[model samples]
Target chain A: MTPALAIRNVSHSYGARKALDDVSFSVPPGSFTMLLGLNGAGKSTLFSLVTRLYAARHGEIEIFGHNIMREPGAALRRLGVVFQARTLDLELSVMQNLLYHAALHGVGPIEARRLGQAALARAGLAERAKDKARALSGGQMRRVEIARALLHEPRLLLLDEPTVGLDIKARADLLALVRELVQEKRLGVLWATHLIDEIADDDQVVILHQGRVLATDRAQAIVVAQGAANIGEAFTRVTGVAQEKLSA
Target chain B: MSEIAAPAGFTFRQYLICLSGVVWREGLRFLHQRERFISALVRPLVWLFIFAAGFRQVLGVSIIPPYETYVLYEVYIAPGLMAMIQLFNGMQSSLSMVYDREMGNMRMLLVSPFPRWFLLGSKLLAGVAVSILQVYAFLLIAYFWEIEPPTKWGYLTVLPALALSGLMLGALGMLLSSLIKQLENFAGVMNFVIFPMFFASSALYPLWRVKESSPWLYYVCEVNPFTHAVELIRFAFYEKVAWTSLAIVFAYTSAFLVAAILAYDPARGMLMRRGG
Candidate 1:
């Protein structure tokens, strides 16, 4: 089966500073792929290329076999992305924000209304739909974003460090919420985060560091290959190889 | 589901819905900020009440074609001030674009399955829609001051001119926003741009007056797109079409919009360089 998200030798830069370098990865359908990296490790840059926020200057990105640059309309129709920043119009009500997003995706008003309500209900934000986005807490706001992302019923969902500012419980809740959807809807998810604990044993993992992909394998397989006891040690071991490779 | 569309996956109905959604959101944003409307109205009214009265005798706008008899400075400058409201509204829309880019929702709009040109066009349409409302509100108040159009149907006739001028000015703002890298520096840039464009144009006074003072200044005003905007509205307010001014404004609108769209293209380097 075609991967939900695929990046092949993608490289991007700003001025002379390289953000992503010779990076490649693929996210299989109906699975949760944790894009593990440190801050400024190019995970956000990878996400940017995938979402076409920044064009893939040097490589190809395919969403369900559709090239992002050449066929963005088709590729993006099945893709949803939640950036790390706060995106809700603070003054607009929750429902209005979702409807605004739906329209951008060419979702009709009546259908947008229906899908918006259902998404909000699924997010457990049904009661807050009429309230302004500012009224919700940070965690609640994140949930609303997830709901908005899913409103178009995308087959692939990409979230960039979505739990950055959330509390421990809120982070776990957000993770569990997405994991449940993957199981039920068979949605492919590329969840980019810096936290290691978010990874599970069977989870597919791509360890990115310093604009380069250090390793790509299952979490447990990486641990075994690197001769590490846990994912935290595996991350450290793979990232260490970067310095030697760079100096060469 | 993954079959490559011919780049026109969306139908006309989807395009309409997208356009309506953008305009609706802009309308809601305007309503939520009632102070914005008040401020847009207040700027034009200030000149009409105080500045125009003071300059009534100092600047003589004799009977021009749009005017059959001697007119008050307030009557003469009303169209310019109408243009003024749009000028400010256009700049405000650009400011919001810069703000929205930082807010991060701009990405969501861009990542939509529609063509980039259409999305930018929708945004321009929304800004023009808001500016029209502000212009009408200003006109309603100016009516009390006896600055109504020269003909009975002047109000209805000026709609097209208002939209055209608004698009031109709003497109200019979007272009400026694309050049702007941050919010902190936008105000300084707007002042340098807005005041010069407004004062040097035919907004507050006619080009003939400037020609009498300085030939170079008259040439400056002649080249200023804002002059055509003012002339277009002034003639439309009198229920006549300023064909030359109409052509100039239309040309500027097309140029500014095309430049803004190109500046925003992902393949280009302007906005992405600014991290927008």
Candidate 2:
């Protein structure tokens, strides 16, 4: 079967500085892949390329066998993206925001309202659907975003540093929610974050460093392969930086 | 049961829905921002009441297309002032685009399965929608203040002209927003594009007056696309069609729309600044 997402030989540059250099990766169906990288590690660049925000001139990106460059409409139809930035219109209610996105995706009113309300309920935000997005807490806002991303029933979901600025409980809750989606819905997920604790031992982890892939494998395999006792030490060994310093 | 999945390709119904959504969002935003509505009115009102009243003696007016005989300076500049409101409102939308691009609202719009041109057109349509309302508001005020009543048909006739000029100015704003990397630079757009375009044209003065003052400035005003926009509105207000002005406004709107679409192209590096 074709992978849910496939990125091959993708490279991008900003003037003389290369943001993503010959980067390649893939996320298989029904699997959770953590794109591990520090800030400026080209994680967002990779997301931008996959999302077709920035065209990649050097290589191709395929979403469920649809090439983003050659067939962006088809490729994008199956893909949903949640950017690192807060995107909800502050004045609009949660349902309004989701329905607006649905409209953009060409979902008619009845179906959009049904799907939007359902997604909100799944995210435990059903009661807050009528409230303005600005009235929600940061964690609730992120949940709204997650609900919005899922409203279209996209096969592949790309979330960039989604848990940022959330409390530990909120972050953990979001991670668990996403993990459940993978198990229950068989949704493919590419979760990008610099947090080490977010990656589970069984999850597929792709370590990116300096616009290049440093490693791609199971968490324990990477730990053992890199001659380290755990993911933290292995990450330090792979990137030649102290993990303590990264968290600090 | 079959799933209600998004179609594999784009569809016309989808495009119309998105365009309507864009327009709807603009209307909601406009309603929320009462201050913006007030400011949009205040700028034109100040020019109409104070500046035009003060300049009435200095700027002598001959019978113009819109006017049957001698008219007050305020009467002469009302259409131009209406266009000015659209111009400023157009730039305001551009400012919002820059803010939206930075804040990630633009990404949501761009990621849709629609063509980039359609998306940009949706944005222009939204801007035009908001701006035309603002223009009519200004026109209502002009009529109440007794700036010089246009023909009864003038109120209705000027709409298409307003829409054309609004789209032209709004398209120019979208083009600038795509090129401009920051919102702070928008002030420079005001100083450069808005002020120059308004002043260099027949907005506040007749082209003949400009010709008398400086032949060079007259040529500049004659060539300025905004002059044609103003002329279009001015003529239409009197139930006459300025064919040259109409054609010029149409052509400029198309050109600006194309340029804006090109600027918004991913290859151009306008939308994808690494940190911007």
Candidate 3:
């Protein structure tokens, strides 16, 4: 079967500065794919292109065989996105934000409420549904965003550093929920992060640096090839940078 | 990997609902912040009740076409007050856009499934709706002050003109929001674009009145798109149709909207800057 998302030779730039250069990757259905990159490695830029927030200047983005630029609505409908930024309306309650998102996707009130509640429950935010988003903690706000993304039951979920600001416990909890989503719902995921701990051995990993893909394969295989016991060293070996330089 | 189903298409009805949803949210937000609504009304109301009062004696009334014989200074400036509300609201909306961008809500809007143009159009329509409400409220207050047109039909005729003029100004706000780089620079926009656009037009004085003061200023007022917007309202309040003003308002709306869309084009790298 065709992969859930196929990106081909996508290249983008910002006025003499290249954000994404000759970047290409694909995510199979029901697979958890982690996009590993440091800051400014074009991870968010790639997400923008995939979600059709920005058109790819010289490449094609195919969401389940639909070209995003040619058929944006259909392509976007198939993909649910959780941006790195907090998209919640601070004044509105959690339920209101979810309902607004659902309406944007053309879901009616009754079904929207049902789906929204289910998604909130899955994100462990059912009780806080009536609370204002601004009243919630940072981790709770992130969970609300995840719940909003799941309202449409998208076939593919694009998360850009979803756990960026979360505590260790929150991060682990979010990752567990994401793993469950991939297995139970058979949804494809593209999780972008710079942190190596977010990756699992069995998960698919794509290493990006300076807007180019360094390697793409099973996470454990890369670690083994690099003769490293964990993903951090493996990432360093693949990107050919010292640990301190990589940290910087 | 199993094959997943393709997603459904978006409908026109869905578009309308989404537009209404966005506009309603804006209205609700506006209502929640009572200060914004009060100020939206108070700014124009102040000029009408206070500034106009101070200038009434010094500013002599003229027999403009829309007016029958000598009109009161306050009555003559009503259309300008209406335009002023829209002008200020337009700038406020632009400021809100910048704030939204800084606060991350704009990113959420950009990622929506709908076309970007549709999203921006919805926002502009919402601003226009709010401005229309302000104009009506001002008109009601003006009636109690006995400064309104003589007929009720005159009031009815002003609605569409208010909408058209509101839309034109709102589009200008949208364009400025997209083009402005930082929130700090927005203050400069108010001083340079907002004040000049309003004062240079016929908002406070008739074009002929400007001519008596300075011929060049009068010429500038006659050519300004904002002057046409005010003229549209002035004529509509008198139960008369000004097609020339109507056409000019439409033209300004189209130009500003097209420029906003182009500036906001995702691939254009206009909004690619990272926000804190």
DockQ score of each predicted structure, in the order shown: 0.62, 0.63, 0.47
For each candidate, what is chain B's TM-score?
0.95, 0.95, 0.94
Judging by TM-score, tell me the better candidate of 2 and 3: 2
Q: Give per-residue CA lDDT, model 2, range B143-211, as digits (tens).
A: 788864455888888889999999999999999988888889998999999999999998998898888
Q: Which 10 successive residues of model 1 chain A have the least lDDT summed?
A: A239-248
Ranking by TM-score: 2, 1, 3
- Tens-place lDDT digits, model 3, residues B1-276: 222453366777778778877887788778777888888888888988999999999988779787778988898888998988988888788888888876767766666778889888888889888888878888888888897776888888988999988988888998889878689988898899878878998878877778888999888888788899999999999999888989989999899989988877776545654322
Top lDDT prediction, candidate number: 1
Model 3 error, position A190 (Å): 1.0
- Per-model root-mean-square deviation over C-alphas: 3.0, 1.6, 2.2
Q: Give the per-residue lDDT of model 3 (tens digit) for A18-85.
A: 88899889999899999999889999889878976677778889888878888777778778888887
TM-score of each: 0.96, 0.97, 0.95
* Chain A, model 1: TM: 0.95
lDDT of 1 by residue, B204-248 (tens): 877887899999999989889999999999999889999999999
Q: What is the lDDT of candidate 1?
A: 0.88
Report the lDDT of model 2 for residue B200: 98
> Taking the tens digit of each residue's C-alpha lDDT, what string does model 1 give over A1-248?
89999999998888789888999999998999999888888887788778877778798999988899898888988898888999999989999999999999888878998998899888888889999999999999999999999888889999999998889899899999999989988889999988888899989999998899999999999999999998888887888643223211
- What share of the reference contacts is kept in model 1? 0.69
Task: Determine the backbone clash count of candidate 3.
Answer: 0
